[model samples]
Target: MNATPTEMMTIAAARLLTNQDVCFVGIGAPSAACNLARLTHAPKITLIYESGTLSTRPSVLPLSIGDGELCDTALTTVAVPEMFRYWLQGGRITIGFLGGAQIDRFANLNTTVVGPYDAPKVRLPGGGGAPEIASNCGEIFITMAMGTRAFVDRLPFITSFGHGKGKGDRAALGLKTKGPTKVMTDLCVLEPDPQTAELTVVSLHPGVTREQVQAACGWPLRFAADVAETPPATEQELAVLRDLHARTRQAHGVAA
Candidate 1:
């Protein structure tokens, strides 16, 4: 079966994870991708949520960080402070999965407001743990559907820093961790340009064109010299992913 764009994005993100990775998972697409990795190839991958669930193996996708399913299936739970101070700040997490309402060319994200801070066009949920996650994770993987509004030239606010301005910015800011190593979107996989720290398309999803990706982005996009076509989702991956979503919908009492 042909994979939907959302499924393709999720599966693409999932493939990047490994059993060795201890991922700090966010809710929504990132949660689905992490859980998919756990349910499939990366069975031993540890999934930690900001709500203090450690090594969680939720059978159904959670609605939020506070969802009961996360705690129920977690191997153990700890105090929020311990989860942040001991686990996150201690540098145990290998990857952090994040998404945002708006992201700039530098991958700096804004989730606070769409317009002005005081008089906003849209008041998005403020960043909860993303700022720390962006700073401390060994590397970050972002997953979000692309749109001109979301893939912006500038963010109204910097909720999470990817590469503050350009190359060496993170080090200059005294953040040792690698910020946003990869951004997986419906159309393509983007990696930061080594020299400039600007996002550059490394691969396009099957049937996705350069024009389509550019049209969706708010900035002048860049592509690698030898950009590759992403491998289409395999039958087993689609089967597993669909089944997971099916179970989640059934468990959540949502129509398929």
Candidate 2:
């Protein structure tokens, strides 16, 4: 069966993880991506949710971090304070997977407000643990659908600092984490330019065009000299992903 772009994006994001990775995972795209990686190539990948679930192996996609499936399938659960202080702040997690309402070229995320902080044009779901996840995890992996509206030249608020004002800022501020390392979207994969710390397109998904990716980005996006085409999802991956989504929908009484 052919996969949709969203599925392709999720699979592409999952490919970044390895069996050795311990990821601090968020819900929605990030959750699906990490779970797919575990169910497929990276079976030993450790998935930790913000709610203190450690090495959760949920059978279906969780609706939220607090979903009972996370606790039910987790290797162990810890207190929220311990989850933050020991796992996250202690730099035990390898990847912090997140999503947001808006992201800037520097990879800083804005989940607080759309227009203005005082009286916003659109108020988003305020940042929960993203600030800590972004600051303390070894690095971050952002998963969001690309669009001009979601990718902005200037974020109204920096809910989760990426590289800060680019290059050395995060380090100057004494953040423990390395900030966002990769951004996975429907069109392509973006990584920080080694020198500038600005997010640059490094790979395009199958059947995606460079123009399409550029059009979606709010800034003048940069591309690596030898950008590669992301490998297509294998049959096994599609099967597992579809089954997960199917189970999620069924559990919620939604049509598949």
Which predicted model would earn the best lDDT? 1
Tens digits of lDDT, candidate 1, 88-185: 99999999999888899889999899889999999999989999999999999999899999999988889999998899999999999999999999
On the 0 to 100 scale, the lDDT of residue 152 in model 2 is 91
RMSD of each: 0.8, 1.1
Clash totals in order: 0, 0
Write out the backbone clash pairs for model 2.
none
Q: How many angstroms is residue 205 displaced in model 1 relative to the true structure, after the best TM-score fit? A: 0.4
lDDT of 2 by residue, 1-256 (tens): 7778899889989999999999999989999999999988899999999899999999988887988999999999999999999988888999999999999999999999988789999989999999989988888999999999999999999999999878999889977568899999988999999999999999998889999999998999999999999888889989999999999999878988
Best by TM-score: 1
Worst 10 residues of 1 by lDDT: 58-67
Worst 10-residue lDDT window for candidate 2 reads 170-179
- What C-alpha lDDT do the candidate models reach, one value each? 0.94, 0.92
Q: C-alpha displacement of 251 in model 2, angstroms? A: 1.4
